[model samples]
Target chain A: MKLSDIFKKKNSGDVAKDRLKMVLVSDRSSCSPEIMDRIKNDIIEVLSKYAEIDQDGLDIKITEMETDDKGTKSVPALYANIPIRNMHHTAK
Target chain B: MGEVIVITSGKGGVGKTTTTANVGTGLSMLNKKVVLVDTDIGLRNLDVVLGLENRIVYNLVDIVEGNCKLKQAMIKNKDNDNLYLIAAAQQRDKTSVTPEQMKKLTQELKAEFDYVIIDCPAGIEQGFKNAIAGADRAIIVTTPEVSAVRDADRIIGLLEADEMKQTQLVVNRLRPDMVKRGDMMSADDVVDVLRVDLLGIVPDDEDVVVATNRGEPLVGDSKSLAGQAYMNVCRRITGEQVPFLDLEAKKGLFGTIASVFKKK
Candidate 1:
């Protein structure tokens, strides 16, 4: 009831919303947090061989893409964009 | 012709059958001819919940297999003259009846009744698919628990994928005391989390258990708040804009302040 209570409290509602957001995001994408982490590591591993990749800037996610189709496509495509600052120039 | 609405919840034991009985009974109380179909197959409970189990001779499977006529299989409720129920076959599983058969059965019922409410089983399996096959509208029921809400969100996504456009939610067994104590999710929090249009919210009531045990739908009892909530949902289904029940307001802001001060 008090204004001070609002700022200090992370109500169960807020906790529920935040948790649902995390889980639903993973559910919709069909990519579990574990799988995403693995994919992130694998991608960085492959990219490290060719260039000094930006591991900190690596982002991998799966989301719905608008295809000229009716339904929210069952298999949403994976979207991964890794930022590359510069390639390692070695013995070239 | 009538609208075939599916009363579904991806997770079990969240009062889907109870909601179906009350909502169907509620609609019938409003003078609408409503028939509830239990498509849960082997795990049949709607008929029992409606107190119509002893009356079912022919079930959904029989109707689909031509063993019984659609009219013959329908069991008219003893409580409401206009309300009816088509019991699911206890001997069969979800695989026995196909979605096409369900669609056909619903279509036939639609021609005869003002509303066809299908009681969908838990999980997004064959039974779930069959239940929603012919439904033009959906009412996804869920509790405030994290697991229930997660399943509800999945059901919403699946319904969207199935192109069942008019999907609404019914948040059941809401505890106001828990919400005020920051121990449970509020109705608004659930709405924002699931991203679905609100159908109704039923406050947590022990009377629901009593009503279920007695096979009497709470919707008929004017004394029950949950009954009032179901009647409101019925009004909404009939295209009347009924406002949601203020579940929180029952224990007003003053009560919260009093409780807060009592800590001293």
Candidate 2:
């Protein structure tokens, strides 16, 4: 931890807002953790046919993202970060 | 026909009953004929909050079961000539009243009163379902706390799923001092996170407890800040454009200066 962090605590209101933002994303999507797991497995199965994926480095979550440049509206978006090791060369 | 509005919060102890009592009383004070309905059933408290507990000869369950007429179950407010209350049955559970019954009851009440305000119980269960079954719109109440705001978000999703699209929010028990100190979320913060139109904000005041203890609504007090806030909410409900209370004004000179600087 930084020395300044020890002396200055984070504002609790900001903390609450941050927490609610993350929590509401999944809540608004109505996607349970189990459903998310199933979705991740399905995506991995599809992607594995095309590339060698680093499964251990995969991360996926539902979050809110701005839909416009003005930031006036936001919508729940699914974000997935998957590490690729190699691509499969297929011949028909 | 009158409008049916349900006052609800998914979590308990966020002042759903108090808001119902005060808003109902405030609407009646505006010369609108209003009736408050407590749909909590077994754990009912709206009647007590309105100070009409002793006058309840019948209740919602009794009326639905045909044991009493709708008029027999409605207890008039002691102070307001236009206000009345339909108390929930203390002995019955949430399952005792079905959504169909509540819808019919609200329809009948709508024909008679200018406003029928329902005090919905906490939790997204049968009680919540029954409360919003017949309502034309909803007023969701939440505090600045994380738990309350979280529950309010969940309720908004549920309400939207049910196609009850006309929903407004009221942030209750807001401590402006804490917000100024950056320790508590402001009403604007909550509205931003919840993504709903803000109806009003009620400051945390001791007068609320005093008024509740006396079996009187704070809106009748006239001197209380929370009472004035609730009155403004009632006026807004009637399509009146009212400015929100300047909560920072209640702070001393030092706070006013701090707020001014913060705005810049």
Candidate 3:
């Protein structure tokens, strides 16, 4: 490797893209991760009372939705893929 | 029928008026009949930018209020017989004209002209709604800044919500020197964030200020880089596929060393 290659700089364009990506992720979600985290905790808390929910394999993520409607629409949608290990055995 | 295009920017002072004037004139120079509409009521500038401020008699409000005919209110360009202007009302605000009225007026103009380019006011409000009401397409102008790009993203969202199917972006005032130094955002940076189809990239040039102040669009000035850029945008708009302009800054000894390694 040449000595000049060692001093090669990270372009500002790359820096700008990195910064914008973080900002846009939050902007599109319209909420901070902390807020979403609290909401997720509350959901699990409430669900545990009704039935036992698998605590270890819970997945909740806020992401964009793609539509098949005629007019183009891009929006954030909450997707939760939770695995229920087993339901609480109830007594009749 | 004519195609109605509105040149807009969510934030102010990003060259919406300048882009409208140049693109309108550029299209007219290509033998396409174009009418430049100044929808920025109460703060009109397209006339001033186009150097037709002194010719305003019956304005947009006058035509909408039935006080004057559309042709009587339209001002013909001295440089190009095909170009015209419909100055906005300076005394009243944006509320004077409704979207329905704007739509009707645009339809009328479409029958007579090949293109009706509306110069939209900054901000997404009554002025913006009214501007796009008559527009079949939109051209968003933005500078290479975080604030400008953020506002542009919001605007693209709003436009998408409005079901505007045709929209493009034009990046303005890009300084090649600053871009080379990594001190400012480049065209690619803006495009990566905006995620809109690239329309044109106008280089930052001082000749634009002089030409704008003189009420002469730089599109006619062959020597001006900004003018040539606008001309290229015009050709692309007319269904001609033109490659983007090369605004790359010349590199020095250090840049040469880094570039040689970059290829490897």
Count of residue pairs whose backbone atoms collide, per candidate = 0, 0, 0
Give the clashing pairs for model 3: none
- Ordered by TM-score, highest first, the candidates read 2, 1, 3
> Which runs in model 3 stand beyond 4 Å of their true positions?
A1-15, A32-92, B249-264
By descending lDDT, how would the candidates be arranged?
A: 2, 1, 3
TM-score of chain B of 1: 0.95
Over the stretch B38-101, how does candidate 3's per-residue lDDT look in tens digits?
A: 9999999999888998989999999999998888999999878999999999999999999999
Q: Which ten residues in a row have the lowest lDDT in candidate 1 chain B?
A: B247-256
> What level of docking quality does candidate 2 show?
medium
Measured with C-alpha atoms, the lDDT of residue A20 in candidate 3 is 67
Shift of residue B242 alpha carbon in model 3, Å: 0.5
Better of 1 and 2 by lDDT: 2
Docking quality band of candidate 1, CAPRI definitions? medium
Q: How displaced is residue B82 in candidate 3, in Å?
A: 0.6
lDDT of residue B172 for candidate 1 = 95
Model 2 bad stretches (over 4 Å)? A1-8, A31-61, A64-75, A80-92, B254-264
**Separate DockQ for every predicted complex:** 0.52, 0.71, 0.34
True contacts kept of 2: 0.83
Runs off by more than 4 Å, candidate 1? A1-9, A38-92, B253-264
